[model samples]
Structures are given as structure tokens and as C-alpha cells.
Target: MGGSLVGRIAAVALTIGSMVCARIALAEDPCLKQVFGRYCLGGEVDPLLQSVPAPAVSQAAADSLALIFPDGENQLYVLAFSRRIYKVVRAYGVSTQLRFDDTYRLLREKYGPGEDRSQFPEYASTPAARLAAIRRGEGRAVHQWMPSPTWHIELSWTRELGISLSYVANALSASRAARIESGL
Candidate 1:
């Protein structure tokens, strides 16, 4: 009887220990504050490496969102999380204005200063959309966007219950993002 009690105690101890560890791991999850390129809180992004493959995302933070400017300028920024390359979420001719205060307001509206409540998993998303946007590369996530002349893209990912919510922000540069600003 004593042995059984000891065994039960051990099991309880272990269970408590495990629960603590899980909390610690979850606490480390990245959020919008960690917004940038590929960020992994628990696992890692496994590059297909079919071709040379963009360098093996050396560090989770190093993984980038490659933006091929309409000007034919291609820049890789640590703003993309990938199992593959990422694409700027765009709707052809929807040219977003680049205003600082307005951009901040948008962010405040979409996500407040803490864990967001509305970031639920999107189920109706098509397979391609899921494959394209969901967290990949060892649970790493990236936020993608394209600045419309006079703006630079910004991104964010915040966590709740160990999941990440990736989002984008368009803060304009002093110049324009496109010559035409309206086209496919």
C-alpha cells in the first residue's frame, strides 16, 4: 500500500513538472512584438531545399519574406515565415494609402496591445490558402505586405494559447510605392 502511494506521488510530481514545462514553452511563443521574418516558438521550418533553397533559415529570426519590387528590385527581409517563399497579400489594384497615424490606428483596431481575442483558425480557407499562409517551417510564421509608394511594410504576430497570429502593416515611405499605383 505504501509503495502504491509512493508511486502515485511520483506520478503526480511528474505531472506537475510536465505542466510547468509546457507553460514555459508556451510562454516563449512569438507574437506581433516578435513580428519579422520566420519565427519559431517551438518547432522549426523545414526547407524543401529542392533547388539550392534559400539558405537554410539559419535562425528563425533570419527567415525572410522576399519582396520583389515592381521596380524589379528584389529584397529579402526577415519578414517572411516559410515552408516556401511568401507572397505579399495583395488584391491587384487595391492601392493602400501610406499614412503613419492611420496605419497605427489600423493596428490598434485589428490587434490591441495584448493577446488578441479574434485570431481563430480559419477553416474555410482553401487548401492552397492554408498552405500559403499558415505557419510553416517548424511552427515559424511570417507576415507579408507590399508598401504602396511612400510606405514600408510592417508585420506582427502575437500569441494566445500557444498559437500565433500573423498580420501586416503598411507604413508609407517618403516616396510612392508605384508609378501607376493602380494595375494588375
Candidate 2:
């Protein structure tokens, strides 16, 4: 009976330790600290719009609004649903392999190497070749990092979209989608 009691106490201690460790690991995830300019995921949209220069265009949908700002050689899109910002994207017009590589390196350095979801044909061996393939609609490059269950960041390049980095709040996005689906 004494040995069994000791073993039970050890098991409880182990469980508590694992819970604490899991919390610590979550707290240390750098992706949770991701932000777009001065805007953060799940932040109010009005404040962010006011802080930035007036957008070049604004479009309103049923449950969401999109603000597009032309910033230098890039375009910034802020998408808000139910007055809260859920997604932000920065699109680069001048897409180049070097530019994409530099951005990829910076993101990897900050958030660790994200899951590379790029689809390249076996024939596309070199970086330039891959870029050419992307331009020709033969392939696309995408890397994504999900820091937590609630948010993710994606960096992608394609012929039509060029190069873009997106920050998304998953929970809010899901809520928006549900609302749209139900015609609410």
C-alpha cells in the first residue's frame, strides 16, 4: 500500500510538471509576438486605420471591409470583420528571387524555419529557375508558421499575386466565415 501511494504521488507530480512545461513552451513561442506594422492580430480596425495613412481604396462587404494602402513599391491590405482586424497582408509588386529569399531569411530567423509548402517541379532546380516557374504559373512558393492554435503567418509568391506576407487570426477568421456562411 505504501509503494502504491508513492507511485501515485510521483505520477501526479509528473503530470503537473508536464502541464507547467507545456505552458512555458507556449509562452516562449515567438510567432505569438507577430505584428503587422503597428497593428496586431485581433486588434480593433478603426484605430489601425486611423494610425496609418489614408488607404488608396476601401471596399465594404457584408461582414467585412478591406482597406488597401499603396506603400512605396508594395501594397498593404487590412481586412477587418465585426470591427476587429483579423488579417493583414503586404504585397510586393517588384517580385524578385533575391527579395523573396531575403524576406524568407528574415522570417525564418525570427520565427524559426516555417513549414515550406512550396510546390516545385523536379525540373526546377535553381532558385532562378523556381522563380521563373512561378512566373509561368508552373509553381508557387508558400511558407507558413502557426505559432499557436489561434493565429498563423503565411509568406507566399505567385505570378498574379507576386510576393505577399499575411498575418491571420484563426479564431476570428473562423467566426467571420461562420457568420458569412449562415447569412448572419
Candidate 3:
């Protein structure tokens, strides 16, 4: 009986240790690790970002960003100018009912008041618009995919403080030749 109890405790401790390590690793964004609570500089993510601090985006504005995404197959991209973790691009067959803030606010409202920050040690307060995830592009070429709603949301950031976000949909077929560049 004594041996069995000891083994169980050991297993629980190992499990807890593993979970902590995984959490830290996931939280370990290169841009954030070096800065350590500093504001982020807008630019291609680099080693020097550690010295800068982060800024705050109001919940309303953050929520509103989601609205810009069009309905009925659209593309949406979020280029995090000041924060790299917030940057992402997703394009998919969007439903007409698709709206941005609906999903985000629910996460916030659930937390209630006086919630401890440590419980959600994540630096970015932004809520996912629609099951968001980090995606790698194919080589140097801008990556493309159909996550839902939009067709394409090309995203890139500068070393300064600018993130380019664009929404595109209902374009020519994929095999068709479509090549052009425009500025804002």
C-alpha cells in the first residue's frame, strides 16, 4: 500500500511538471521573451524587440476589427504592428452571420470581474475571431489557405510599427494568373 501511494504521487508530480513546461514553451514567443513586458516595436519580428514595451488596444476596437471581415467567403488578416502574437491571416468560406466581436466578448464576459492575470498569463488580451491559429507560409511566398469566409488575407509586418492587413475574396480561380500589388 505504501509503495503504491508513493508511485501515484510521483506520477502526479511528473504530470504537473510537464504541463508547466508545455505552457511556458507555448508562451515563449521570441518577440515577447526578450522584451519581458515591454511595448512591441512594429517591424518584422527580430531579436531587438526585447527592449520595447507593448500597448493596449481597447476591447471595442479589437472587437471591431473582426467586423471588417466580409461575409459569404471572405479573407481576413491581422498584422500585429505592436504585438507579434496577435498577428495572423485566415481565409475561409464565411457564413453571412459571421461577425467578429461575438466570439471575443463571450470569453471576456465569462471571466467576470477581479480575475487574476496569472490565471491567464497570456500577454495579448485579444480574443480569437474564429478558431484562430498560427500558420506558416510556404517558403518566402505568401502562404494561402481557406480557413473559412474570406479567400485571402495577406499579412506582413515591418520592423518599425506597421502591420499590413488586407481582405480579399471572390477572385479569379486559383489556377488563373493573378499578380498585382497595391499600397494603402
In terms of lDDT, the best-performing candidate is 2
Tens digit per residue, CA lDDT, model 1, 38-117: 43212222432232434433334333333322212222232334332222322112212233235445655654533222
Which residues of candidate 3, in runs, are more than 4 Å off?
28-44, 47-80, 83-152, 155-184
TM-score for every candidate vs. truth? 0.27, 0.71, 0.24
Q: C-alpha displacement of 105 in model 3, angstroms? A: 37
* Model 2 lDDT-worst window of ten: 28-37
Candidate 1 at 152: error in angstroms?
18
Residue pair clashes in candidate 2: none
Every candidate's lDDT: 0.34, 0.84, 0.32
Supply every candidate's count of residue pairs whose N, Cα or C atoms clash at under 3 angstroms: 20, 0, 26
The parts of candidate 1 lying over 4 Å away from their true place are: 31-184
Return the top candidate by TM-score.
2
